[model samples]
Target: MQSDPHHDSANSVELPTPTAWPIITAFGLTLLFLGLVTTLFVSLAGFLLGLIGAIGWFGDVFPHPKHEPFPIRPHDEWPKDVCRVGRTVTHLHVGEHGHREQFPAAVHPYTAGFIGGLAGGAVMAVIACAWGYLVDQSLWYPVNLLAAAGLPELSTASTEVLKQFSLAGLVVALITHVTTSVLVGLLYTVLLPMLPAKREWIWGGILIPLMWTGLIWASLRFINPTLNARFEWLPFVISQIAFGMVCGFYVFRSTKVSTQQGWTVAARLGVEAQHPGEKKP
Candidate 1:
Protein backbone atom coordinates (compact mmCIF):
# COMPACT_ATOMS: atom_id res chain seq x y z
CA MET A 1 0.00 0.00 0.00
CA GLN A 2 1.22 3.49 -0.84
CA SER A 3 1.41 5.97 2.06
CA ASP A 4 -0.11 9.48 1.58
CA PRO A 5 1.99 12.53 2.40
CA HIS A 6 0.62 15.28 4.75
CA HIS A 7 -2.97 13.82 4.78
CA ASP A 8 -3.86 15.48 8.16
CA SER A 9 -3.48 19.17 7.36
CA ALA A 10 -5.74 21.27 9.64
CA ASN A 11 -6.46 24.09 7.09
CA SER A 12 -7.01 22.25 3.80
CA VAL A 13 -9.57 23.70 1.30
CA GLU A 14 -11.58 21.42 -1.00
CA LEU A 15 -11.57 22.20 -4.73
CA PRO A 16 -14.95 22.68 -6.61
CA THR A 17 -15.97 20.26 -9.36
CA PRO A 18 -14.38 21.21 -12.74
CA THR A 19 -17.62 20.94 -14.81
CA ALA A 20 -19.66 23.49 -12.73
CA TRP A 21 -17.97 26.61 -14.13
CA PRO A 22 -18.50 25.61 -17.75
CA ILE A 23 -22.15 24.72 -17.14
CA ILE A 24 -22.86 28.07 -15.50
CA THR A 25 -21.03 29.97 -18.26
CA ALA A 26 -22.95 28.07 -20.93
CA PHE A 27 -26.32 28.89 -19.32
CA GLY A 28 -25.50 32.60 -19.17
CA LEU A 29 -24.40 32.69 -22.83
CA THR A 30 -27.52 30.84 -23.90
CA LEU A 31 -29.75 33.38 -22.13
CA LEU A 32 -27.90 36.27 -23.74
CA PHE A 33 -28.15 34.69 -27.22
CA LEU A 34 -31.90 34.04 -26.79
CA GLY A 35 -32.55 37.60 -25.72
CA LEU A 36 -30.71 38.96 -28.72
CA VAL A 37 -32.58 36.69 -31.16
CA THR A 38 -35.99 37.58 -29.68
CA THR A 39 -35.29 41.28 -29.79
CA LEU A 40 -34.12 41.10 -33.40
CA PHE A 41 -37.12 39.04 -34.46
CA VAL A 42 -39.61 41.44 -32.84
CA SER A 43 -37.89 44.47 -34.39
CA LEU A 44 -37.95 42.91 -37.84
CA ALA A 45 -41.61 41.92 -37.60
CA GLY A 46 -42.62 45.38 -36.38
CA PHE A 47 -40.75 47.12 -39.19
CA LEU A 48 -42.22 44.91 -41.89
CA LEU A 49 -45.73 45.24 -40.50
CA GLY A 50 -45.41 49.01 -40.32
CA LEU A 51 -44.15 49.21 -43.90
CA ILE A 52 -47.03 47.15 -45.23
CA GLY A 53 -49.58 49.11 -43.25
CA ALA A 54 -48.21 52.40 -44.52
CA ILE A 55 -48.42 51.23 -48.11
CA GLY A 56 -52.02 50.10 -47.73
CA TRP A 57 -53.04 53.35 -46.05
CA PHE A 58 -51.27 55.47 -48.68
CA GLY A 59 -54.38 55.50 -50.84
CA ASP A 60 -57.44 54.30 -48.91
CA VAL A 61 -59.05 51.59 -46.79
CA PHE A 62 -62.66 50.56 -46.34
CA PRO A 63 -62.07 50.11 -42.61
CA HIS A 64 -64.39 47.17 -42.04
CA PRO A 65 -63.16 46.97 -38.49
CA LYS A 66 -64.83 44.55 -36.10
CA HIS A 67 -63.67 43.02 -32.85
CA GLU A 68 -65.25 40.88 -30.14
CA PRO A 69 -64.18 40.13 -26.60
CA PHE A 70 -63.88 36.79 -24.90
CA PRO A 71 -67.19 36.63 -23.08
CA ILE A 72 -67.35 36.49 -19.31
CA ARG A 73 -67.85 32.83 -20.21
CA PRO A 74 -67.67 32.40 -23.95
CA HIS A 75 -67.26 28.66 -24.44
CA ASP A 76 -71.01 28.14 -24.17
CA GLU A 77 -71.74 30.12 -27.28
CA TRP A 78 -69.62 29.31 -30.31
CA PRO A 79 -68.38 26.90 -33.03
CA LYS A 80 -71.76 25.81 -34.43
CA ASP A 81 -74.75 28.01 -33.56
CA VAL A 82 -76.02 30.07 -36.50
CA CYS A 83 -78.39 32.18 -34.45
CA ARG A 84 -77.83 35.69 -33.12
CA VAL A 85 -77.97 37.38 -29.74
CA GLY A 86 -77.36 40.70 -28.04
CA ARG A 87 -77.62 44.21 -29.46
CA THR A 88 -75.48 47.14 -30.56
CA VAL A 89 -72.94 48.20 -27.93
CA THR A 90 -72.91 51.97 -27.63
CA HIS A 91 -70.65 52.77 -24.66
CA LEU A 92 -66.99 52.06 -23.96
CA HIS A 93 -65.02 51.94 -20.70
CA VAL A 94 -63.56 55.31 -19.80
CA GLY A 95 -60.80 56.21 -17.37
CA GLU A 96 -62.86 57.06 -14.29
CA HIS A 97 -64.94 53.86 -14.40
CA GLY A 98 -61.87 51.69 -14.94
CA HIS A 99 -60.06 53.38 -12.06
CA ARG A 100 -62.93 52.26 -9.86
CA GLU A 101 -62.87 48.67 -11.14
CA GLN A 102 -59.04 48.52 -11.08
CA PHE A 103 -59.07 46.99 -14.54
CA PRO A 104 -56.42 47.09 -17.24
CA ALA A 105 -56.76 48.62 -20.81
CA ALA A 106 -58.26 51.85 -19.36
CA VAL A 107 -61.36 51.08 -21.40
CA HIS A 108 -63.78 48.16 -21.54
CA PRO A 109 -64.18 47.38 -25.23
CA TYR A 110 -67.20 45.05 -24.92
CA THR A 111 -69.88 47.39 -26.21
CA ALA A 112 -67.85 50.45 -27.11
CA GLY A 113 -65.69 48.55 -29.68
CA PHE A 114 -62.04 48.87 -30.85
CA ILE A 115 -62.01 52.25 -32.59
CA GLY A 116 -65.44 53.14 -31.30
CA GLY A 117 -66.21 56.60 -32.55
CA LEU A 118 -62.72 58.05 -32.29
CA ALA A 119 -60.98 57.59 -35.66
CA GLY A 120 -63.69 58.79 -38.03
CA GLY A 121 -65.07 61.34 -35.61
CA ALA A 122 -61.68 63.06 -35.61
CA VAL A 123 -60.94 62.61 -39.33
CA MET A 124 -64.34 63.85 -40.48
CA ALA A 125 -63.75 67.31 -39.06
CA VAL A 126 -60.71 67.99 -41.24
CA ILE A 127 -61.13 66.03 -44.51
CA ALA A 128 -64.82 65.95 -45.47
CA CYS A 129 -65.88 63.63 -48.32
CA ALA A 130 -62.31 62.90 -49.42
CA TRP A 131 -62.01 60.45 -46.54
CA GLY A 132 -65.47 59.12 -47.21
CA TYR A 133 -64.71 58.61 -50.89
CA LEU A 134 -61.43 56.87 -50.11
CA VAL A 135 -63.26 54.67 -47.63
CA ASP A 136 -65.86 53.88 -50.27
CA GLN A 137 -63.10 52.98 -52.69
CA SER A 138 -61.50 50.61 -50.23
CA LEU A 139 -64.71 48.68 -49.42
CA TRP A 140 -65.22 47.73 -53.06
CA TYR A 141 -61.64 46.99 -54.16
CA PRO A 142 -61.95 43.25 -53.47
CA VAL A 143 -65.01 42.96 -55.64
CA ASN A 144 -63.37 44.93 -58.45
CA LEU A 145 -60.35 42.65 -58.31
CA LEU A 146 -62.61 39.62 -58.53
CA ALA A 147 -64.51 41.14 -61.41
CA ALA A 148 -61.34 42.08 -63.25
CA ALA A 149 -60.19 38.50 -62.92
CA GLY A 150 -63.49 37.53 -64.59
CA LEU A 151 -65.82 36.29 -61.91
CA PRO A 152 -68.81 34.98 -63.80
CA GLU A 153 -71.45 37.19 -62.12
CA LEU A 154 -69.46 40.41 -62.12
CA SER A 155 -66.69 40.06 -64.71
CA THR A 156 -68.34 42.63 -66.93
CA ALA A 157 -69.61 45.14 -64.36
CA SER A 158 -67.58 44.43 -61.23
CA THR A 159 -66.05 47.87 -60.96
CA GLU A 160 -69.32 49.76 -60.61
CA VAL A 161 -70.86 47.26 -58.21
CA LEU A 162 -67.70 47.03 -56.10
CA LYS A 163 -67.58 50.80 -55.83
CA GLN A 164 -71.10 50.86 -54.47
CA PHE A 165 -70.48 48.13 -51.87
CA SER A 166 -67.23 49.76 -50.75
CA LEU A 167 -68.98 53.08 -50.29
CA ALA A 168 -71.76 51.45 -48.27
CA GLY A 169 -69.61 49.26 -46.01
CA LEU A 170 -67.26 52.15 -45.27
CA VAL A 171 -70.14 54.40 -44.38
CA VAL A 172 -71.66 51.76 -42.14
CA ALA A 173 -68.56 50.53 -40.25
CA LEU A 174 -67.23 54.00 -39.58
CA ILE A 175 -70.48 55.39 -38.23
CA THR A 176 -71.13 52.33 -36.09
CA HIS A 177 -67.72 52.31 -34.41
CA VAL A 178 -67.71 56.04 -33.83
CA THR A 179 -71.25 56.60 -32.59
CA THR A 180 -70.89 53.71 -30.18
CA SER A 181 -67.44 54.67 -28.81
CA VAL A 182 -68.56 58.16 -27.83
CA LEU A 183 -70.01 56.88 -24.54
CA VAL A 184 -68.60 55.41 -21.31
CA GLY A 185 -68.86 51.57 -21.43
CA LEU A 186 -70.60 48.85 -23.33
CA LEU A 187 -74.38 49.16 -23.24
CA TYR A 188 -74.73 45.37 -23.23
CA THR A 189 -73.34 42.15 -24.68
CA VAL A 190 -75.19 40.64 -27.60
CA LEU A 191 -75.93 36.94 -27.56
CA LEU A 192 -77.90 34.50 -29.72
CA PRO A 193 -78.64 31.01 -28.49
CA MET A 194 -79.44 27.86 -30.43
CA LEU A 195 -80.79 25.59 -27.70
CA PRO A 196 -82.28 25.74 -24.21
CA ALA A 197 -78.72 25.46 -22.83
CA LYS A 198 -76.19 24.58 -25.51
CA ARG A 199 -74.75 27.37 -27.70
CA GLU A 200 -74.62 31.18 -28.00
CA TRP A 201 -72.98 33.91 -30.07
CA ILE A 202 -71.03 36.61 -28.30
CA TRP A 203 -72.00 39.73 -30.33
CA GLY A 204 -75.56 38.93 -31.45
CA GLY A 205 -74.13 39.64 -34.94
CA ILE A 206 -76.79 42.15 -35.82
CA LEU A 207 -75.91 44.49 -38.72
CA ILE A 208 -77.88 47.22 -37.03
CA PRO A 209 -78.51 50.29 -39.15
CA LEU A 210 -75.52 52.38 -38.15
CA MET A 211 -75.64 55.45 -40.42
CA TRP A 212 -78.13 54.47 -43.01
CA THR A 213 -79.67 57.40 -44.95
CA GLY A 214 -78.79 59.80 -42.17
CA LEU A 215 -75.52 61.31 -43.49
CA ILE A 216 -77.36 63.39 -46.08
CA TRP A 217 -79.80 64.53 -43.44
CA ALA A 218 -76.95 65.57 -41.15
CA SER A 219 -75.03 67.45 -43.83
CA LEU A 220 -78.08 69.22 -45.18
CA ARG A 221 -79.50 70.19 -41.78
CA PHE A 222 -76.67 69.78 -39.28
CA ILE A 223 -73.11 70.54 -40.41
CA ASN A 224 -71.92 73.91 -41.71
CA PRO A 225 -68.14 73.54 -41.34
CA THR A 226 -67.51 76.46 -43.73
CA LEU A 227 -69.43 78.60 -41.30
CA ASN A 228 -68.02 76.15 -38.67
CA ALA A 229 -71.51 74.93 -37.83
CA ARG A 230 -71.98 71.19 -38.21
CA PHE A 231 -74.04 68.81 -36.07
CA GLU A 232 -70.61 68.35 -34.57
CA TRP A 233 -71.89 67.43 -31.14
CA LEU A 234 -75.23 66.05 -32.17
CA PRO A 235 -74.25 62.75 -33.83
CA PHE A 236 -72.43 61.77 -30.68
CA VAL A 237 -75.47 62.31 -28.54
CA ILE A 238 -78.11 61.07 -30.99
CA SER A 239 -76.75 57.55 -30.78
CA GLN A 240 -76.60 57.39 -26.99
CA ILE A 241 -79.28 54.81 -26.08
CA ALA A 242 -78.27 52.26 -28.80
CA PHE A 243 -81.57 50.48 -28.22
CA GLY A 244 -83.11 48.85 -31.22
CA MET A 245 -86.10 47.07 -29.77
CA VAL A 246 -86.15 44.91 -32.86
CA CYS A 247 -82.66 43.77 -32.07
CA GLY A 248 -83.39 43.36 -28.38
CA PHE A 249 -86.42 41.19 -29.04
CA TYR A 250 -84.59 39.11 -31.63
CA VAL A 251 -81.72 38.33 -29.26
CA PHE A 252 -84.01 37.59 -26.33
CA ARG A 253 -85.91 35.17 -28.50
CA SER A 254 -82.77 33.21 -29.30
CA THR A 255 -82.02 31.90 -25.79
CA LYS A 256 -80.72 28.36 -25.47
CA VAL A 257 -80.20 25.88 -22.60
CA SER A 258 -77.33 27.31 -20.59
CA THR A 259 -74.74 24.54 -20.31
CA GLN A 260 -71.42 24.36 -18.46
CA GLN A 261 -69.75 26.62 -21.03
CA GLY A 262 -72.58 29.18 -20.86
CA TRP A 263 -74.21 31.31 -18.20
CA THR A 264 -74.97 29.84 -14.73
CA VAL A 265 -78.04 27.71 -15.15
CA ALA A 266 -80.56 25.89 -13.03
CA ALA A 267 -83.44 23.56 -13.75
CA ARG A 268 -87.00 24.57 -14.89
CA LEU A 269 -88.48 24.51 -11.36
CA GLY A 270 -87.82 25.05 -7.65
CA VAL A 271 -85.07 22.44 -7.61
CA GLU A 272 -81.47 23.49 -8.29
CA ALA A 273 -79.01 21.68 -10.49
CA GLN A 274 -75.64 20.98 -8.89
CA HIS A 275 -72.75 22.60 -10.64
CA PRO A 276 -70.21 20.23 -12.13
CA GLY A 277 -67.39 21.05 -9.72
CA GLU A 278 -69.05 22.63 -6.68
CA LYS A 279 -70.11 21.28 -3.29
CA LYS A 280 -73.40 22.05 -1.52
CA PRO A 281 -73.47 25.34 0.30
Candidate 2:
Protein backbone atom coordinates (compact mmCIF):
# COMPACT_ATOMS: atom_id res chain seq x y z
CA MET A 1 0.00 0.00 0.00
CA GLN A 2 1.21 3.51 -0.88
CA SER A 3 1.70 5.85 2.10
CA ASP A 4 -0.13 9.19 2.08
CA PRO A 5 2.75 11.58 2.68
CA HIS A 6 0.62 14.69 2.36
CA HIS A 7 -1.58 13.66 5.25
CA ASP A 8 0.76 12.62 8.01
CA SER A 9 -0.98 11.12 11.05
CA ALA A 10 2.09 10.54 13.25
CA ASN A 11 3.08 14.16 13.79
CA SER A 12 0.66 16.76 15.08
CA VAL A 13 1.75 20.19 16.24
CA GLU A 14 -0.48 23.26 16.42
CA LEU A 15 0.85 26.69 15.48
CA PRO A 16 -0.08 30.16 16.75
CA THR A 17 -2.72 32.21 14.96
CA PRO A 18 -2.17 35.72 13.59
CA THR A 19 -2.38 38.46 16.20
CA ALA A 20 -2.90 42.26 16.00
CA TRP A 21 0.80 43.20 15.68
CA PRO A 22 0.55 44.02 11.96
CA ILE A 23 -2.50 46.20 12.46
CA ILE A 24 -0.82 47.99 15.35
CA THR A 25 2.30 48.52 13.26
CA ALA A 26 0.24 49.98 10.40
CA PHE A 27 -1.41 52.43 12.74
CA GLY A 28 1.95 53.41 14.15
CA LEU A 29 3.25 54.13 10.67
CA THR A 30 0.19 56.25 9.95
CA LEU A 31 0.83 58.25 13.12
CA LEU A 32 4.49 58.65 12.19
CA PHE A 33 3.45 60.09 8.80
CA LEU A 34 0.99 62.46 10.46
CA GLY A 35 3.51 63.40 13.17
CA LEU A 36 5.44 65.50 10.66
CA VAL A 37 2.50 67.95 10.85
CA THR A 38 1.59 67.23 14.48
CA THR A 39 3.30 67.71 17.87
CA LEU A 40 6.74 66.21 18.71
CA PHE A 41 5.33 63.94 21.44
CA VAL A 42 2.86 62.45 19.01
CA SER A 43 5.68 61.44 16.68
CA LEU A 44 7.66 60.05 19.63
CA ALA A 45 4.67 58.01 20.77
CA GLY A 46 4.16 56.67 17.27
CA PHE A 47 7.80 55.67 17.01
CA LEU A 48 7.74 53.85 20.35
CA LEU A 49 4.51 52.09 19.52
CA GLY A 50 5.80 51.13 16.08
CA LEU A 51 8.99 49.66 17.52
CA ILE A 52 7.15 47.60 20.13
CA GLY A 53 4.52 46.44 17.66
CA ALA A 54 7.16 45.49 15.11
CA ILE A 55 8.95 43.34 17.71
CA GLY A 56 5.74 41.71 18.81
CA TRP A 57 4.63 41.23 15.21
CA PHE A 58 7.83 39.45 14.23
CA GLY A 59 7.68 37.27 17.35
CA ASP A 60 4.09 36.35 16.60
CA VAL A 61 4.86 35.60 12.96
CA PHE A 62 7.92 33.42 13.64
CA PRO A 63 7.92 32.46 17.26
CA HIS A 64 11.16 31.20 18.75
CA PRO A 65 10.93 27.59 19.95
CA LYS A 66 11.72 26.75 23.55
CA HIS A 67 14.08 24.11 22.16
CA GLU A 68 16.65 24.83 19.47
CA PRO A 69 15.26 24.41 15.96
CA PHE A 70 16.99 22.80 13.00
CA PRO A 71 18.81 25.29 10.77
CA ILE A 72 17.44 25.37 7.25
CA ARG A 73 19.38 27.16 4.55
CA PRO A 74 17.81 29.62 2.15
CA HIS A 75 15.56 28.16 -0.56
CA ASP A 76 18.31 28.52 -3.18
CA GLU A 77 20.58 26.17 -1.26
CA TRP A 78 18.00 23.40 -0.88
CA PRO A 79 18.22 20.36 -3.16
CA LYS A 80 15.62 20.01 -5.89
CA ASP A 81 12.91 17.43 -5.39
CA VAL A 82 10.66 15.92 -8.10
CA CYS A 83 9.71 19.41 -9.29
CA ARG A 84 12.11 21.10 -11.70
CA VAL A 85 11.21 24.52 -10.26
CA GLY A 86 14.66 25.78 -9.25
CA ARG A 87 14.41 27.76 -6.02
CA THR A 88 10.71 28.54 -5.83
CA VAL A 89 10.01 25.36 -3.90
CA THR A 90 6.45 24.74 -2.77
CA HIS A 91 7.06 21.37 -1.11
CA LEU A 92 9.74 19.10 0.29
CA HIS A 93 8.64 15.57 -0.64
CA VAL A 94 10.61 13.96 2.19
CA GLY A 95 11.83 16.16 4.99
CA GLU A 96 14.29 15.49 7.82
CA HIS A 97 11.51 13.81 9.77
CA GLY A 98 10.78 11.63 6.67
CA HIS A 99 7.54 13.31 5.77
CA ARG A 100 6.23 15.71 3.09
CA GLU A 101 6.56 19.36 4.05
CA GLN A 102 6.00 22.83 2.72
CA PHE A 103 9.07 24.90 1.94
CA PRO A 104 10.24 26.82 4.98
CA ALA A 105 10.98 30.07 3.18
CA ALA A 106 10.09 31.98 0.03
CA VAL A 107 12.11 32.17 -3.19
CA HIS A 108 15.43 33.97 -3.14
CA PRO A 109 16.04 37.21 -5.07
CA TYR A 110 19.24 35.97 -6.80
CA THR A 111 17.36 33.10 -8.41
CA ALA A 112 14.66 35.46 -9.68
CA GLY A 113 17.32 37.92 -10.91
CA PHE A 114 19.20 35.25 -12.87
CA ILE A 115 16.05 34.17 -14.70
CA GLY A 116 14.96 37.78 -15.30
CA GLY A 117 18.42 38.71 -16.63
CA LEU A 118 18.46 35.87 -19.18
CA ALA A 119 15.00 36.91 -20.40
CA GLY A 120 16.04 40.55 -20.67
CA GLY A 121 19.22 39.66 -22.54
CA ALA A 122 17.24 37.60 -25.07
CA VAL A 123 14.76 40.46 -25.69
CA MET A 124 17.59 42.98 -26.01
CA ALA A 125 19.44 40.80 -28.54
CA VAL A 126 16.29 40.48 -30.68
CA ILE A 127 15.73 44.23 -30.55
CA ALA A 128 19.34 44.91 -31.51
CA CYS A 129 19.13 42.62 -34.53
CA ALA A 130 15.83 44.15 -35.69
CA TRP A 131 17.06 47.69 -35.22
CA GLY A 132 20.31 46.94 -37.06
CA TYR A 133 18.40 45.42 -40.00
CA LEU A 134 16.08 48.42 -40.18
CA VAL A 135 18.94 50.92 -40.30
CA ASP A 136 21.67 49.16 -42.32
CA GLN A 137 19.60 46.62 -44.32
CA SER A 138 21.79 43.90 -42.78
CA LEU A 139 21.67 42.32 -39.29
CA TRP A 140 25.47 41.97 -39.43
CA TYR A 141 26.08 45.73 -39.50
CA PRO A 142 25.75 46.47 -35.74
CA VAL A 143 27.25 43.12 -34.73
CA ASN A 144 30.21 43.92 -37.00
CA LEU A 145 30.59 47.21 -35.15
CA LEU A 146 31.06 45.31 -31.87
CA ALA A 147 33.60 43.00 -33.57
CA ALA A 148 35.33 45.82 -35.43
CA ALA A 149 35.67 47.78 -32.23
CA GLY A 150 37.81 44.98 -30.82
CA LEU A 151 39.83 44.43 -34.03
CA PRO A 152 42.07 47.35 -35.06
CA GLU A 153 42.21 46.28 -38.77
CA LEU A 154 38.41 46.40 -38.99
CA SER A 155 38.20 49.53 -36.83
CA THR A 156 40.45 51.58 -39.19
CA ALA A 157 38.28 50.80 -42.25
CA SER A 158 36.31 53.87 -43.39
CA THR A 159 32.47 54.00 -43.14
CA GLU A 160 32.35 53.59 -46.94
CA VAL A 161 34.42 50.37 -46.75
CA LEU A 162 32.13 47.37 -46.42
CA LYS A 163 33.71 44.20 -45.05
CA GLN A 164 32.25 40.67 -45.01
CA PHE A 165 30.35 39.66 -41.85
CA SER A 166 32.69 38.70 -39.00
CA LEU A 167 31.93 35.58 -36.95
CA ALA A 168 34.26 37.02 -34.31
CA GLY A 169 32.11 40.14 -34.09
CA LEU A 170 28.88 38.22 -33.59
CA VAL A 171 30.44 36.21 -30.76
CA VAL A 172 31.89 39.31 -29.08
CA ALA A 173 28.66 41.28 -29.34
CA LEU A 174 26.55 38.40 -27.95
CA ILE A 175 28.82 37.86 -24.96
CA THR A 176 29.04 41.57 -24.14
CA HIS A 177 25.30 42.11 -24.51
CA VAL A 178 24.36 39.06 -22.40
CA THR A 179 26.84 39.95 -19.64
CA THR A 180 25.59 43.52 -19.38
CA SER A 181 21.91 42.49 -19.50
CA VAL A 182 22.31 39.89 -16.74
CA LEU A 183 24.17 42.35 -14.50
CA VAL A 184 21.46 44.99 -14.94
CA GLY A 185 18.73 42.41 -14.27
CA LEU A 186 20.43 41.27 -11.06
CA LEU A 187 20.72 44.89 -9.89
CA TYR A 188 17.01 45.47 -10.52
CA THR A 189 16.09 42.39 -8.46
CA VAL A 190 18.22 43.50 -5.51
CA LEU A 191 16.90 47.07 -5.44
CA LEU A 192 13.23 46.30 -6.14
CA PRO A 193 12.86 44.08 -3.06
CA MET A 194 14.32 46.72 -0.69
CA LEU A 195 12.44 49.68 -2.16
CA PRO A 196 8.91 50.78 -1.33
CA ALA A 197 6.36 49.38 -3.79
CA LYS A 198 5.31 52.61 -5.53
CA ARG A 199 5.65 54.07 -9.05
CA GLU A 200 7.77 51.03 -9.90
CA TRP A 201 7.24 51.24 -13.66
CA ILE A 202 8.37 54.85 -13.94
CA TRP A 203 11.31 54.47 -11.57
CA GLY A 204 12.50 51.02 -12.61
CA GLY A 205 11.45 50.70 -16.26
CA ILE A 206 11.82 54.28 -17.57
CA LEU A 207 14.07 56.39 -15.32
CA ILE A 208 16.69 53.71 -14.73
CA PRO A 209 16.98 52.95 -18.44
CA LEU A 210 17.28 56.66 -19.25
CA MET A 211 20.08 56.98 -16.73
CA TRP A 212 21.85 53.89 -18.11
CA THR A 213 21.52 55.18 -21.68
CA GLY A 214 23.12 58.51 -20.78
CA LEU A 215 25.92 56.77 -18.90
CA ILE A 216 26.62 54.44 -21.83
CA TRP A 217 26.49 57.32 -24.33
CA ALA A 218 28.93 59.35 -22.28
CA SER A 219 31.31 56.43 -21.72
CA LEU A 220 31.25 55.24 -25.35
CA ARG A 221 34.49 57.06 -26.23
CA PHE A 222 36.36 55.16 -23.53
CA ILE A 223 34.54 51.82 -24.05
CA ASN A 224 35.01 51.82 -27.84
CA PRO A 225 35.45 55.04 -29.76
CA THR A 226 35.10 53.30 -33.12
CA LEU A 227 31.84 51.64 -32.09
CA ASN A 228 30.70 54.98 -30.60
CA ALA A 229 31.25 56.69 -33.97
CA ARG A 230 29.51 53.84 -35.79
CA PHE A 231 26.49 53.62 -33.47
CA GLU A 232 23.27 55.42 -34.40
CA TRP A 233 22.23 57.38 -31.29
CA LEU A 234 18.44 57.03 -31.57
CA PRO A 235 18.29 53.30 -32.24
CA PHE A 236 20.75 52.55 -29.46
CA VAL A 237 18.80 54.71 -26.98
CA ILE A 238 15.49 53.04 -27.85
CA SER A 239 16.98 49.56 -27.58
CA GLN A 240 18.39 50.29 -24.12
CA ILE A 241 15.00 51.57 -22.93
CA ALA A 242 13.29 48.46 -24.32
CA PHE A 243 15.78 46.18 -22.61
CA GLY A 244 15.26 47.92 -19.25
CA MET A 245 11.50 47.69 -19.44
CA VAL A 246 11.53 44.00 -20.33
CA CYS A 247 14.05 43.20 -17.59
CA GLY A 248 12.07 45.19 -15.01
CA PHE A 249 8.85 43.40 -15.90
CA TYR A 250 10.45 39.99 -15.45
CA VAL A 251 12.13 40.94 -12.18
CA PHE A 252 8.93 42.48 -10.82
CA ARG A 253 6.84 39.47 -11.72
CA SER A 254 9.24 36.82 -10.46
CA THR A 255 10.19 38.06 -6.99
CA LYS A 256 6.78 38.84 -5.53
CA VAL A 257 5.69 37.04 -2.28
CA SER A 258 2.13 37.39 -1.06
CA THR A 259 1.44 38.15 2.61
CA GLN A 260 -1.73 36.09 2.27
CA GLN A 261 0.39 32.94 2.33
CA GLY A 262 1.61 33.82 5.82
CA TRP A 263 -1.95 34.13 7.07
CA THR A 264 -2.98 30.86 5.41
CA VAL A 265 0.01 28.98 6.83
CA ALA A 266 -0.67 30.38 10.28
CA ALA A 267 -4.34 29.44 10.06
CA ARG A 268 -3.48 25.88 9.05
CA LEU A 269 -1.12 25.61 11.97
CA GLY A 270 -3.79 27.01 14.29
CA VAL A 271 -6.17 24.27 13.16
CA GLU A 272 -3.56 21.60 13.75
CA ALA A 273 -2.84 23.06 17.19
CA GLN A 274 -6.53 23.08 18.15
CA HIS A 275 -7.15 19.45 17.16
CA PRO A 276 -3.85 17.60 17.41
CA GLY A 277 -5.37 14.10 17.31
CA GLU A 278 -8.02 14.82 14.62
CA LYS A 279 -7.37 14.90 10.88
CA LYS A 280 -7.13 18.50 9.48
CA PRO A 281 -10.07 19.41 7.23
Error of 1 at 54 (Å): 47
TM-score of 2: 0.50
Predicted structure with the largest TM-score when compared to the true one? 2
Clashing pairs in 2: 14-273
TM-scores of the models, in the order given? 0.21, 0.50
Error of 2 at 190 (Å): 0.4
lDDT of 1 by residue, 154-219 (tens): 334434554555444445444553554333112322212222333322222222223322453455
How many clashing residue pairs appear in each of the predictions shown? 23, 1
Could you report the Cα RMSD, in angstroms, for every candidate shown?
A: 25.2, 22.2
**Model 1 Cα displacement at 118 (Å)?**
20
